[model samples]
Target: MPDDTAKPERKRQARGEKRIEELLDAAAEVFAERGYKAAGTNEIARRAGASPGTLYQFFQNKEAIAEALMARYVVRLRAAHGEAFDPAVAELPLEEMLDRIIDPVVAFDRANPGFYALLADPALSPELASAKKPAQKLMFQRLDQILERRAPDLPAEQRTRTAEVAVHLFRGLLPLIMTATEAELPVLVAETKEVLFSYLSPRIDLEATPQHNRRTLTPEEAARKAAHIAMRSNVTTDDVLTAIHEARAEHVRAVENVLDRDHPREDRR
Candidate 1:
């Protein structure tokens, strides 16, 4: 007979949910202070006021901690996106619609300071990116539904293309938003709305125009008026292209600044 002293493999302890929360919170701060690659489990355990043994009881390594944090972030992100892109928002005025969309996203970003750093980092574990897929799909689905409501006659292909462009355009703004100081953030948010509104206005019906003036301009007139406004600001196609290049350069610089301040690669010094 097998020795009675032999025991089954011990299941991981599940008693310290509060302590686990504290650990994850500490991990987020460490990851924010030092990029994930540079962040250490020891520091996280110290910050959480737990012994290494205690932390190991729950998590096998730094990667496990990160995966847990990423899971929490996904839950929050999905909830925020779900609220921001509600179908009823399609009936709201353009400015209100923009506020509804922008406010929750900004709030979410402010609440999860380390999330963008982790999400954008090419060095992040594959598990994190995989976890984000469902949230991404749900976000697009909500946007697609809104688009469908706004322009029921839009061709299926056109609607899909529009949704894709909108998603990519908004996502491109995340780095700038994440890196910006609070003083600079509101302006960036406003500019994001302006850029998104411009892109989306043409694709939807004339409803996005001011209510009193909605019926006044034909699509041709509306296009010309939008162009005229840009012309008044001395903006041209070349100017637009230049701005795009500058924004891309700015985004690259911002990401580098963030990563450098946090993780400072040895050779890059």
Candidate 2:
């Protein structure tokens, strides 16, 4: 005998996984097109040629399906971002870092515009919104690591804050790119770089300074430094100071948690 039952079981499991993928793909498209509030599980099921029961077998409800789709998208985007940043490529000038990060995202958006649209939608629930922060954090952390390697003299607090700002600034500009005319992309990219450089380049200088000496400032020192800089700058410094405080606090807590071997810090992003 050829173990006919074993073959059937394997085939069924493969088919089930395929069905799940199809459902998720369809859900992403539907949610993007119709907006999350307007889209329904039944529609996703119909698009996937599966029943509501089949969807339930894989996901509890529409929200569960949406969360899974978002998670998958994050994984894909992060992987693509990682692949784009070779050590050779990262060694290029500071300006090129903008292109390295932004180009991958722009390419990803061009290929999967729906995901960007879904991210732009305001109807995303609290859970999905919470999930998104960690993804952003991971991407920023990766960029920070690259920056650290290139600018070894930079302070940890400055590097962390700079990375956080760059990620969010890139994200905020995405909607504009999505809506840009064919002739406008170059202008948009140039202006985005200009704005980012204007703000970030000085911080890089601060980080590269020998006085910084790669010192990891305490949370209070980080906050005070950020506030002092903010007072001297044209922008709001309190926001920067607050972010530095949070990042420092979180880092300390994470290290303590690890040493205590209690609840391991969840590096979701």
Candidate 3:
């Protein structure tokens, strides 16, 4: 005999999940386009090709939809943060480490446009803001761990404050980045990472053996100095340095030629 009861229940649950996902995706698009204040649940249902009743079955209102999308984004953000700060890549130069962190975070924000809308929505009440606190807290906790590893000797209180500041600053900047056009985003992102790396790298001890490379440029400093020298040209600091050396060599040869002419080589011989 077929067990009809369980099979129908399973199918119903699967369909429910699919409907929820469709509604959320539609809500994300609508929220991103019109923002939370202007977007309506009916429009979300229309975008999803479902009736208003169907949307109501999954979400009581637009706020409910926003909350659901925020929850989903938080899960994704946590995963991205974990991957960015993976301990396997911890020993990389601070510049590379910051790159890893920034790339994943920017990617996440780009992938979920509605997340920023809801997160930074001016009309959001304190209750809505409270819902996001856990995710923010989780991110800060992960940052604290990263900072602790980078500067193991840093005082616990100081480390906590540093992590909180870093996370808050990043959160504050992300909405602006999200608003930028695609053509302008890379430059903005690059500048942001450069600023962040310059600010944070010196505060932590990242080099494995500092004494071994006393004169060697740390990646952060090297990039900044190189970019300065390169300016608007396709030149690098190494190229500039090489040109200086060649000019010096040519000057030395000219001086030697003048001396030899003034006191002919054969006269000495």
Candidate 4:
């Protein structure tokens, strides 16, 4: 007699993998269309042609599927990195080198907008968050290698810092560019590249004193300089000072808003 229980368990495992793939595909579509917060697990199961119970057998919930999807994304992104940094492309100029670094990321976001949407969610699962560290480290390693080869004169510390800064700057901006209007994205990309290059290679008089030696002004001295400038203009000193205060207040408000959006406040009993 066949071991009936063993056969059924094997079939269940096969079905479970197939069902997980289907669920991930459905979840990706839903996340792209409605975003992570608005997406529903039931809708994903429905699209996958699986019952809710079947879906649950493979994943604990929608968040688990999202985490899996992000893991798959990292795998695909690593492949893209290989493509971007292949030996054939390594001969390109520095500008093209920068493009190679950025293009893979932008292409991935464009190809899998839903997965990118899930990554943008503030409530991302811990597994997905942990996955990001390895991906970031790989990106940093790649950029650091390229910079070392291209700008051999750059100090080791500066190269490391630049790689760190570039990865973060691009990661934060890529999602915004992915979601921006077509007309707006090009402008943003150009301006971002300009700012990055300025930071990496500022024009300096090699013969003059290093920029680090410039006298640092105290807050009071800075304010007095501003006031003196305001006195020469049509604007009153009071008006200038008030404008400065308002700008500071607005900056504080913006930081608080970002914190509130990214983190939950504790409830008081």
Among all candidates shown, the one with the greatest TM-score: 3
lDDT of each candidate versus the true structure: 0.66, 0.64, 0.66, 0.60
User: What are the runs in model 4 whose C-alpha is more than 4 Å off?
Assistant: 1-16, 87-91, 202-269
- Candidate 4's displacement at residue 33, Å, is 3.4
Ranking by TM-score: 3, 1, 2, 4
Task: Tell me the tens digit of each residue's lDDT in model 2 across 1-269.
Answer: 68879988999999988998999888978876787878899999999999888888999988888788878888888878776565555576556766776677677776666566566565678997776665556667777887787767888887877676555545545555565667877776665555555545556644433232334343333333333333333334333332333344554343343323422223211
Per-residue lDDT over 1-269 for candidate 1, one digit per residue giving the tens place of the 0 to 100 score: 98654443222233377789999999989888788899898999999999989999889998888888888888888889889988889887766787898889878877787675566556666776676566556656778888898789899877876666556555555555666778877877776666566667767755454443333332223223332323333233222222223223433344344434543455222
Query: Tens-digit lDDT track for model 4 on 162-224?
Result: 565555445534544676677766765664454344333331112223233434332233333
Candidate 4 local lDDT, residue 245: 38
Judge candidate 2 against the unseen true structure and give its global Cα lDDT, from 0 to 1: 0.64
Task: Assess the local accuracy of residue 25 in candidate 4 as a C-alpha lDDT between 0 and 100.
Answer: 89
Q: Give the per-residue lDDT of model 3 (tens digit) for 31-58.
A: 8899888998889999999999988888
Q: How many collisions per candidate?
A: 0, 1, 0, 0
Q: lDDT value for candidate 4?
A: 0.60
lDDT score, candidate 4, position 73: 75
Off by over 4 Å in 2: 117-123, 205-269
Identify the superior model by lDDT, candidate 2 or candidate 3. Answer: 3
Candidate 1's C-alpha lDDT?
A: 0.66
